[model samples]
Target: MAKEKFKDAEKGNAVEKEAEDLENGNANADAAVPAPLYPKMAEDPRARWAFIRKVYTILASQFLFTSAVGAVGAFVHPIPKFFLSGGLTSIVVFVAILLSPFIAMFPMLIFRRKHPINLVLLAIFTACISCSVCILSSFFGVKAFLEAAILTCTVFIALTLFTFWAARGGNDFTFIFPFLFATIHVLLVYLIIQLFFPLDRIVYTVYSLLATLLFSGFIIFHTESLIKRHGYDEYIIAAIDLYLAGVNLFTSLLGLAGIA
Candidate 1:
């Protein structure tokens, strides 16, 4: 009985020692592994990919609708004439066009997560933006619009590809956002000053070049944010970010070409 009791005590010690070893091993292993840079990204891969697909799909739809409206405004003489004709109706339409985005945007933000309502708001926002694009394109004529469209598409594709490659290589671009914000505000102030002062053509050219570069940076920044900072559930916000960047790029390109 004494021998048996001693043997049992030895067995218990061995088992306890094994468990302690396992616990230390696990701790060491965990310590060796790096923490995820984006915790939300560590969710299911399928969900993340699906989110990207949805965002791009929505963005494509937005571009298509804007392009269509732009075509109508540019090619259809009656529409542009009606809008550009100096009258109370034209003035009202012009003001409405300028204000439409803000009107739709606020409601969209409020209902961004509310399913079909959010979708409705998104459509309204897209239509508003489309109207603005259409009006701008109408001023530029078909040839200039087409040229700007081609250039914008090229720039957008290149930037998107570069963004993906840089992301894969572990580059981060979120840091540039503050600089971008400051620069945009400065540009807006400059734009307001330009409106009052009527700067030279060379100055306008420089301004357009700077704006193009700025919006290009926005494309890179926003695209990377989509891959890194945004979660799967923020597809609406992501789509809007990319769409705005695209629209701004086109407008800047138009200005760069001296067509706007």
Candidate 2:
């Protein structure tokens, strides 16, 4: 009887020791992974409001520059003529303008967090991309360009206001990102195939509409992300996110207007 009692005591001690080790292990694991602090930053009203103001200010400046460049490209008679002219000089200029955005993007991304340099790089990137956009706009002429610009602005404002209201109501739009990402990849593949075989007019129209909606979803997602997910120091990235979505939406709208 004593032998059995001793054995039982040993088993109890072993189990207790194992449970203690398990608790320690869990504590270590938790310590190893530091908790994210963005929630704290995002929760502060002053910080959140400041971040929003900075991001929107930068975005507004970019759009102003883009609008100025677009007007010059569309309404300036000589500018359109020069770009449209089928000559060696025109071809060279067109190719350079097309390639400029890619060239600027690399440095802009690299210096995205480097303060004054980052701002300079952002300006260069904005200029290059805006130039490319305006060049494309020139091809559609003044009336279509103006209409698309107005529509893009109106849609952007409505979406911005809606996103703010939705976010304030505790709506999370980040879940749609995976679906949007997958669909955009599929659309990209379809567009590449179109280079070899031209799509039917109806098909192209459908594609354009799909792209416009996709970008609209992106704007909403990114805007909500700005409100809830982005860190305090991520203002530049936030601006870029909104700007890219707006530009893509504008291009898609421009395509529709051109076709119409």
- Which candidate number maximizes TM-score? 1
TM-score of 2: 0.81
- Cα miss at 22, model 1 (Å)? 26
- TM-score for every candidate vs. truth? 0.82, 0.81
- Give candidate 2's whole-model lDDT: 0.86
After superposing candidate 1, which stretches have Cα over 4 Å from the reference? 1-41
Question: Considering only N, C-alpha and C atoms within 3 Å, which residue pairs clash in candidate 1?
Answer: none
* Candidate 2 residue-wise lDDT at 247: 88
What does each candidate score in C-alpha RMSD? Answer: 7.2, 13.0
What does candidate 2's lDDT look like per residue over 1-260, in tens digits? 99999999999999999999999999998786544323343265656777888999999999999988987777877877887789999999899988998898888888888899988989998999899888888888788788889999999999989988776666678889999999899889989999999899899889989999999999999988887878877877899999989988888888899899
For model 2, which pairs clash? none
Model 1, 1-260: lDDT tens per residue?
Answer: 99999999999999999999999999998786644334344655555666778989999999999988988877877777877788999989998999999988998988888888887889999999999988888877787788889999999999999988777777788888898899899889989999889878888888888889889999999898887778766788899999999999898888766434
* Overall lDDT per candidate, in order of appearance: 0.85, 0.86
For the record, the alpha-carbon RMSD of candidate 2 to the native fold, in angstroms, is: 13.0
> lDDT of candidate 1 vs native?
0.85
